[model samples]
Target: MENRNRFPHPLFYLFPLYAIGLYFLVLGVINAYVFLAPISIAALMTMILLPVVRKFENWKINRFLSTFLATCLALSLYLSMFVVISLQANSIYENWDTVSGRVQNTVQKVQESISGISGVSPDKQLEILNIPPSALSSDSTNAVNSQKSEKDSTSKKGETKESTAKQNSGVKAAITNFLDFVGYSLLTFIYIFFFLFYRTKIRLSIVRFFPENQRDKTNKILNGSLSIAKQYLVGRLILIFFLWIIYSVGMAVSGIDSPILISLIAAALSLIPYVGTVIGYVIAMMMAVVSGGETGQYIGVSITYGLAQFVETYILEPFVVGDKVDLNPLVTIIVVVLGGLVWGVVGMVISIPLFGMLKILADQVTVLKPLGYFLGQDDMGSKDDDFLGAIAKKLKRMFK
Candidate 1:
């Protein structure tokens, strides 16, 4: 009896155990994500640059030197992009006075145009709609006026100049943030270095998670995850590059000032998925407006963006991103939202590739096949209304 009890039925408790484990796993990840996000990012970066590291290793270069060189290359690219963006931002700040003046003028012109309509002037429209002017009781109006006067008196009394002190504080805060960012970046590179140096050992450790018989399958999954990360990263970079080129040419043709800077910044912003497209459009329009471009130039830029978006959606993305992820629209949106909620923009950017990796793992494991199918392109739940009907017919025939 004791021997028999040792091999309990799977249906009795296995499913509940599995569910409990999964719940805890997800909870842990969410709670610890701040510490984990950098690790995950470093891993993805390693996937992208692993080949370069390996190439140097193959050439008999020391592993530490190879990793350092690879990290330097990545850092230089990042710093160059940052500098370009910073320059554009600084230009916008310098031009704020002109831009603000133009914006006010544009608004005044819009108001004039609206008021020009004979029967539909704003005052007439409001009158026709029967919306009365906001009116305060005499006592309330007096109270408000007195309050405002008192505030102004207090402001005049306390209006000593401390702009220099404020500036110093702002500089100190910026320096502190820069230092923190540098420290985090240093940690990330160290993580990448260790990952490169211990790639084989890490693979072996991962393989040990499975039974001895399943090590091969585990290794294959690990490799597939790496491949997906590399492909996704490369595809995104190519897309960004193409966007930059298209935006640059269009802005130049439209005679916008700082066209290259505007284009590069707009193109990079386009990496944020659905939200990014709208942002890119707004940024381009703002750049055009601030540069005092003609209305025709604005229309031209819009047309250029529309065509580029069409080409990107219909041609470039489908080919380049391919079916690497294979997540359906519903799952994709949910994960994106969840990622955004958890990690902000970084979460949104990485969610798709992370989901792709999860899908691969789900597909590989037999117990998780149902999840794999759900993450896949199939609509298994709605395969047919006749599915039950077919089963009933088969049962009836067999019983008959």
Candidate 2:
């Protein structure tokens, strides 16, 4: 009995092994991400588009045709957005000169304002930043003349050939990257199609992996995970639509050019959580400045973003997204940051739903239920009973 007591728990003995396995698991995920990302994204996409496929089936459409139609519909929607954004981008390129001038003027005004407030002239600020005044100046008078005479006298032909070769290589690289993207997209759609077509088989196979006695529980957990992903994604799409509308109307009212383009970009960036929203605000502000917007216009953009965020956090999220994922705030932030570090923007976008699925699995498994509890929101308790609050209380007690 004394020896048994000394052993404590089985998990305590196995903790080192668990840590080693976890480290390898994370390393494997990072290394295999190139292959895994497409499948994971396809799985999520399948979950989102499953209902559409089901509806077609209900209308007596065959599974193959239904899957094809659903995939095409998704593809078309993505393509339409791509076309719109590309056209808007081309418009910006065409007017880049005017935009650049306005941006420079705005920057100058801002620097003057800062100089007034901080009692440091713009030149002094530039010197402190280690940037020469000529670098920021629109006129390249002295610098261009000095470089032109030297270039004309020495190695101009060789330099031109080298520059040309560099441009050619850059173009080739761009084309190759574009082709890779297209091929990956095609592969992802194929994965989605197969996943949809054989979804039932896949589900049964997953269930069969467990013992007969646990099969029912496994199936239940799998279904619950799929439900969480579906609801979260669908609700997020609804939220994005509303955000786009609000942002567009707000930017237009503020007299910003290409409001639709800016709003759509901002709405899309909302996928990355807290960081995305900040980026969207900065983008909108830059656009405002580039459009030669006055102080009132700047204030309008601020008010618009403020109101949009207020609506998103207070009204839309609570109602639309609800507690679908049901993750605690701390866990949400940590997982998002971890996901970003692991897989970049795509990882950040999918992290919440993926973690939500993991939480479901944890809740269903006896040994992991404690982990699920930690991951879940604490709606049942007051602030003091929550994790951080409890930690604060313990610290206070120890100090006292």
Indicate which candidate wins on lDDT: 2
Candidate 2 structure quality by residue, lDDT tens digits, 167-251: 9999999999989988888888889999999999998888888999988798899989999999999999989999999999999
Residue 301 CA displacement from its true place in model 2, Å: 1.6
Error of 1 at 56 (Å): 2.0
* Pairs with backbone N, CA or C atoms under 3 Å apart (clashes), candidate 2: none
| Highest TM-score scorer | 2
Give the 10-residue window scoring lowest on summed lDDT in candidate 1.
131-140
Question: Candidate 1 at 26: error in angstroms?
Answer: 6.1
Worst 10 residues of 2 by lDDT: 387-396
